[model samples]
Target: MLSAGSLATLFENTIGPAFDDAHEYGYRGEFHGSNAVMRMVLDEQKQPDVIVSADAELLRTRLPEDIAPWDVVFGSNALVIAYGPDTAVGERLEGEEPWFEVLSEADAEIARSDPDLDPLGYRALQLFDLAEQYYDRDGLAPALTENLVIDPQEAHILARVEAQERAAAIVYKNMAVDHGLPYVELPEKLDFSNPEHADYYAQATYTTEDGTTVEGAPVLYNATVPSTAPNPEAGRAFLKFLLSNPEMLTENGLVVTDAFPRPHGPVPEEIVP
Candidate 1:
C-alpha cells in the first residue's frame, strides 16, 4: 500500500495489521505525501496493491482513468498548529492569545510541508489566508509567513516538534494526535474541514512549484486500487474491509461523513454500498 504520510500510524499500527490478521497475509505500506506517492507510480513505475491519498480531487485529477479507474471518499480531517510545549513559543501558545497572533510574534520558525509535494503544505497556507480574512487582521498572513520552514515531509516536521528541534508545525489533527502533541485547532471557517465552508475555503488559493493552482476545499481522504496493482484481489478486499468497518477511522481521529465511503466512477460493486 502507498498512503498519505499523515496516516502512517493508522496503517502501520491498526489497518495494516487488521487486514493481515483477517486475510492471513502481511501487507507492506509506504507513506509519503499524496502527490509524491502518485509521482512514484507515474515517474518511478512503482506499483503497490493500493493507493490512499489525502486529497480526493488529486486522485481524480492526477491519475489517469486506466491507472485508477475509481476512488472512494472515506474520511476527513482538519488542520492544526501543533506546538512543542517545551519551546518559548509553545509557552505563550498555551495562553489565551489567538494562535495566529502568537505565531506572528514568535521568533521560532513555524514548520510546514512543501506545497509542491503535500496537500497539507498548501492547506496550511490556505488556512492562514482564510484566517486573516476571518479575523479581519490586515497583513496577518504575510506576518506569519516571516517564519515558515517548509519541509517535504509533514511527519518529519512533527518529529522535529516532538524533539523540540522545531517550535511548531502545521499538520493534520490526526497527525497531532498520533504524535501526542498539543495543538491549537483552527475554526471550521479557516481549517478547511467543514463542507459548509467550501465556498469560503475556495477564496484561499495556492500555486505549486509546477504552477498548478490549488484552491482550498474540505479535506477528504480517498483510496483506490490502481489497474496496475500487483495484488488487485488483496486491494479490493482491503477497501471492502475499510469501508465496512469505519470505526477504525474514527478511532484514529478522522471524521467519517454520513454519506461517506461514497464510491465514484467504476469502483467494484462489492465495495460499493
Candidate 2:
C-alpha cells in the first residue's frame, strides 16, 4: 500500500489483516512522506493500486486528472508532540502547561520531519507559525525550528523518539496514540483537526527554497485509486471495506467521517456521502 507515514501504526495492525482476509491477498503498507509519494508516482514512475495522502486537495493538485480523478476524504487527525520514553520531561510534556510554554523549556529537544519532502514537516512549521501569532510571541516560529533534528519523514522522527535519540517530535496525534507513545496535545485552535478553523489555519504559511508557498489547513486524510492500478477491482473492494468500518477506524485512532464522502470521479458503489 502507498500510504502516508502518519498511518504507519494503523496499517501495521488493522488494514493489512483486514485486506488479507477480505481479498485473500497478503498486503503490507509502506510508510512514506505524503508529498514524497506524489513525487515518486509522478517523477520516479512508481505505481501502486492505492495512494493515500494527508491532504485531500493534493490528489487534484499533484496528480494528473487521468491518474487520480477522484479521492475520498476519509479521516481527521491533528498534531501532537510525541516525547521519548518515561522521562520527567516526557511526563510533563503531556498537557501539563500551555504546550508552547512547556516546549520552550531549556531542556526540550525538538525534532521535526523535513518540510520539503513530507506534509507533517510542512504542517509542523505551520503549527509553529500559527503558534507565533496565537501566542503573540515574536520570532517564535523560527525559534522553534532552530536546532531541530530534521528527519526525512514522520516515521523517521518517531523512530528517533522511540530510540531515545531525540527528546521529542512533532507528529500526528493518531500516530502517537496508535503507537502507545507518550504525547502532549495541542489546543484545538492550534491543532489542525477541525475544518471549521480552516480560515484561521490558513493564516500560517511556509515557503520552500524554490519559492513554493505551503499554507496551513486542517489535517485531512484522503485516498484514491490510480488509473494504472494493477488490480482495480481489488482496489475498489478494499476501499469499500475501509469506508464500511467506521467503528474500527475510530478504534485505531482515526476520527472518520460518519459517511464516505462523494468523490469527483468513478467510485465504488460502497462509497456514500
Candidate 3:
C-alpha cells in the first residue's frame, strides 16, 4: 500500500493490523507526500496494492485515468497551529487570546512543509490567506509568510515543533494528536474543515514556487486501487473494509462527518456502500 505521510500512524499501528486480524491478510505501506508517491507510481513504476491520498483533487485530476480511474473520498482533516508547550507562542495559545492575534504578534519562527511536495504545505498557505480574510486583516498572510521555514515533509515539520527545534508548525490536526503535541485549532473558515464554506475557501489560492497553483477546498482524504496493482484482490478487499467502517477514521481524530464514502469515477460497486 502507498499512503499519505499524515496517515502513517493510523495505517501502520492500527488499520493494517486490524485488517489482518479480520481478514487473515496483512500489507506493508510506504508513506510520503501524496504527489511524491504518485510520482513514484508514474515515474518509477512502483506499484502498490492500494493508493491513499491526502488531497482529493490530486487523486481526481493528477493520477491518470488509466492508472487509478476510480477513487472514494473517505475522510477529512483540519489544520491547526501545533506548538511545543515550552515555547512562548504555546503559552499564549493556552490562554484566552485569539489564535490569529497571537500568531500575528509572535516573533518566533514557524515551520511548514514545502507546498510543491505536500498538500498540507499548500493548505497552510491557503489557511493563512483565509485567516486574513476571515479576520478582516490586510497583509496578514504576508506577515505569516515572513517567518516561515519550509521543510519538505509534514512529518519533519511536526517533529520540529515537538522537539522545540522550532516554536510551532501549521499541520494537520491528526499529526498533532498522533504526536501528543499542543495545538490551537483555527476557525473552520480558515482551517478548510467546513464543506459548507467551500465558496469562501475557494477564494484563497496558493501558487507554489515551482508554479503549480492550488485553490483552497475542503481537506479530504481519497483512496483507490490502481489499475496495475500487484495485489488487486487484496486492494479491493481492504477498501471494502475501509468504506464499511468509517468509525476507524473518526476514532483517529479526522472529521468523518456525514459526507463520507463518496465514490467517484467507475468505482467497483462492492466497495461503494
- Where does model 2 exceed 4 Å of error? 209-211, 259-262, 270-273
Q: How do all the candidates rank in terms of TM-score, highest first?
A: 1, 3, 2
Could you give me the TM-score of model 2 versus the true structure? 0.91
**Which scores greater on TM-score, model 1 or model 3?**
1
Query: What is the lDDT for 182 in model 2?
Result: 81
| Per-residue lDDT of model 2, residues 1-273, tens digit only | 688888877777787787788776567677788878888888746778788888777556888888898788888888888887565457666537666766665365688888877778888889988999998999887777774678876765777777777778898888888767888778887889888899999988877654667778888888888888888766777676677677777887778765445465666556542
Where does candidate 1 stray beyond 4 Å? none
Error of 1 at 153 (Å): 1.8
For model 3, the stretches where C-alpha displacement exceeds 4 angstroms are none
Per-residue error for 129 in candidate 1, Å, reads: 1.3
lDDT of 2: 0.77
Candidate 3 C-alpha lDDT tens digits along 119-187 = 888888888888887888999988888777887776556887777888889889988888899788878
Q: Considering summed lDDT, which 10 consecutive residues are worst modelled in model 2?
A: 257-266
lDDT of 1 by residue, 1-273 (tens): 899898999889999899888985568988889888888888756898889999888888888998988999999999989999989888988975789989999999899998888799889888888888899999999998889898777556798888888899999999898888999988889887888888898999999777778889889999999999878988888888888778998988899978798788988898865
Model 3 clash pairs?
Answer: none
Lowest lDDT 10-mer window, candidate 3?
Answer: 205-214
